[model samples]
Target: MPENDRLRNIRKETLSSAWYTLYRYDFEYRRSDGRWESRQREVYDRGNGAAVLLYDASRRKVLLTRQFRMPTFVNHNPDGLLTEVCAGLLDGADPEAAIRKEILEETGYRVEQLEKILEAYSSPGAVTEILHYYLAAYHPGQKEAEGGGVPEETEDIELLEFGFEEILEKVRNGEIRDAKTLILIQYAALFGPLRPVAREIQ
Candidate 1:
């Protein structure tokens, strides 16, 4: 390894486990002004994951999910139930493959084609997670199974389908607060295939 390029004396200690792993990290950093500083921070790592925004252009509708998140609950969220896009941890699988399985379990939509939007860090400050964003076209005919999430995983997920335009309104009004979900909604509004068309006066 190169000597004293930027970071050095790296160390980590495990904090917790279960669905994800938490670690406390310590290292010495070389600042821009050629100064060395020691720093430490705790990071939560559940591994990278994938998410999708499913929409039906014909009906102008979108599919999302609602579920109780323990973290949200403990952090002062009233009910802890969040409305979000279908998503799941990669769990040692490819991003696209993982998302396909996740969507199947969360929304019952058989995704044949998915447009990868981008990859993002959920919270780089303290989370070692990269979220792969995606968008897919879906219709009622594509439903394969009842998508309430995997029962064995103890996921009590609820399927939610709403008007394409109406959901964005909820986002603006502070109803939908999930970061990934909000990103997908704003992306769909600006660049999705189901955008509304404005007609010129005849």
Candidate 2:
């Protein structure tokens, strides 16, 4: 959907084409007083994505991933390895299907049940990607393989299994920084699948 009338005269120019597309936008922003001003902005279009927090009720553990992120490395992360939920671009698949496939690839979890929680723009100010969020439950018998993502994609992912309560502390202490991952974990802890687990903290 396009922006409403508060914005006008949108002009977009292609600026880069590496892993994702970047564009420069020149537009007119209408003031509340009915005045208008010229504005310019840049947006990165990496396409939309889906992510899920996978949990095992019996073990009170959650599935997470650890991998190097170049962006964070350059941004002062001595170790670029990030703890995150299973996530990936939709790439033409429906949101539900994409998260399921991501779980299988990133963690080897073959999930049978999924609960979609919310959708949000993780970085709306500069990025144009909307993320679909979900929660999934898994068991030992459902692990189909030792998943480390596809080798061709340069994905050398490491699996991280943490007790639900422990991971929340990781989040509180700034150990988890990936936006979507943090959101999903907190979602599960506060209002979604893992609410009971979080409640036990009190």
Candidate 3:
């Protein structure tokens, strides 16, 4: 049976809409034993987003960003600062187009060609955000502006560049803790552009 067929009495209530949206879902779920149980879950709909790893194969370097994340700060991050790949909410745009714009807005690199890696949900149990992942090659000549994110959005992003091996070391030492960043780095190590160098170091 389809998953939807196992659910009934579905209803949603908006809990908050100030930022994105928080919805409470009440429904009856059919269990494996054929019993129906009432359940409620709060889901956050912050809209889908995209992320990209900008690398220069010749130089063996990758471009990343540093910014303050309030959620991380409140949880346990020492200073709320996190190093992450360039990313942003899609805001109703296509994944590729959105990521390309984000790359320019956050890194100042206008890359013409992007290789999409995969798409995954950020936090399926609570957040309704499917993040598209991409990889793009970039060089200094592509810099068009001093990208620090949009001023009106209060986004103060700092661009950081690190050698491929240096970044992998950071990942091992627990310095790079962002999930999306980790995913892209691991992908590069296993099968993407950085595979050659990554394998050499291993």
Candidate 4:
């Protein structure tokens, strides 16, 4: 341990089965200084891994999915249909590989190039999920399947493509409501225009 390092204490932890699609867990910890703490952490507990939010640069648009989320249903919406970028948990795969796989699985959109934008924790205070956001470019003929998502996973998904104005409208109309999606969209709005050109002919 380093001299400047701080000590953290955990007093208790409990995990429930991942009913539906969400991981359920409870935790309590106490610090070395005698302070006590408690929290509920979500994730497989095998490990915390990477996720990605994919963006399309040339279209000046983003691809998102509308799927039912259990947590959202519990909180407010029984419908719980959420609009989110192509994303998936990285069990052990590299972030880029995970993004590519998820893109294929979720949207059936193939990419020729992919670039990393940022890596961040989904929520530091409780959960142990991290996201590696990415941007990629795809051509018109690349979209393949209906891409409704996996059925064994119980996913009922609708693929959607949104222009900048459309997403801004969604945001203004309170349609785009997920936190991670909000963050990624805002990041794109402020910085998307700066993305490098795919075709630079000499």
Number of the top-ranking candidate, with TM-score as the measure: 3
What is each predicted model's overall lDDT from 0 to 1?
Answer: 0.87, 0.89, 0.93, 0.66
Q: Which ten residues in a row have the lowest lDDT in candidate 2?
A: 193-202
Better of 3 and 4 by TM-score: 3
What is the overall TM-score of model 2 with all chains considered together? 0.95
Task: Write candidate 1's Cα lDDT for 26-137 as tens digits.
Answer: 8999999999999999999889999999988888788999999988999989999999999999999999999999999887778789999999999999898999999999
In angstroms, the error of model 1 at 168 is: 1.3
Best by lDDT: 3
lDDT of 2 by residue, 127-155 (tens): 99999998888999998988999999999
**Candidate 4 residue runs with Cα over 4 Å from true position:** 1-5, 8-14, 17-60, 194-202
On residues 138-167, what C-alpha lDDT tens digit does candidate 3 reach at each position?
Answer: 999999989989989999999999998999
lDDT of model 1 at position 53: 94
Q: Where does candidate 2 clash, by residue pair? A: none
Residue 27 error, candidate 3, Å: 0.2
The regions of model 1 sitting more than 4 angstroms off are: 1-4, 197-202
Which of the two candidates, 1 or 4, achieves a greater lDDT against the reference?
1
For candidate 4, give the lDDT of residue 31: 62
